[model samples]
Target: MKVLLLICVLALTACTKESEELRMRVQQSIPVPATMSQVLNRGILYPTAGIQVTGVVRVVQLSSGKQLQIDSFSITPGPDLKVYLSQNALPGNHLNLGNLISNNGHQAYNIPANTNLSAYNYVLIHCQQFNHLFSYGKLQ
Candidate 1:
């Protein structure tokens, strides 16, 4: 009986350690805006432009009717790009290139269903002039 109890305790301890390690990895990889103007203007000799996050996204709720959110991230190009989100991996649910704004760095939409509340995963981000993609994991 004592041997069985000891084995069970050891198994539980191992599980706890594994969980802690996973949490650390998730926290370390939260995606922020990537500065890519130099790559965008490699050939041109024009003045350098700045890219910034224009809008703030505190929390994006995903419910039945609230499936999509059109977050605007504008660039100096004078066009506002729209980012779309869906609940599933269907035609309209994934993130792509055409939705990204040229100069603005928006935190893209968060699809609640696709996100893992327990762990971090990648989400789709889109823009117009550039179809840039990024990853963001679950936050505590």
Candidate 2:
């Protein structure tokens, strides 16, 4: 009986450690006024390679400025994941929006005022440390 209890405790500890490593929090929360913000373009994310992602990404025009909003998002968690506005499916010549706030839930990132929205046709979720493209959505 004592041995069984010890094994259960060990299993619980391993699960806790894994969850801690995968957990991520919002880095920035940019609020867009609901009445003033307009969604200029929107797209549904498609996973790249084997990575999994589900969400809708939106290019929002706000009275204060422009921003990228990810709504109802969930992704396979990984290290150094970042958000980018790119000219293609890849990251070359892309605008680094910022680190993704979390692997799940709604989040927003401010886009620089000088960025020409027309120049970017896709939104990318990338892993900087590993140079992996996790997912992307074509703005339409």
Whose lDDT is greatest here? 2
lDDT tens digits by residue: candidate 2, 93-120: 8999888888998888889999999999
Worst 10 residues of 2 by lDDT: 19-28
Per-model lDDT: 0.34, 0.87
Off by over 4 Å in 1: 1-49, 65-74, 78-98, 101-112, 117-140
Residue 41, model 2: lDDT of 96
Error of 2 at 111 (Å): 0.3
lDDT of 1 by residue, 10-110 (tens): 98888434587788985564333332311110111111234323332223333331122222433334343444332332224444323442344443233
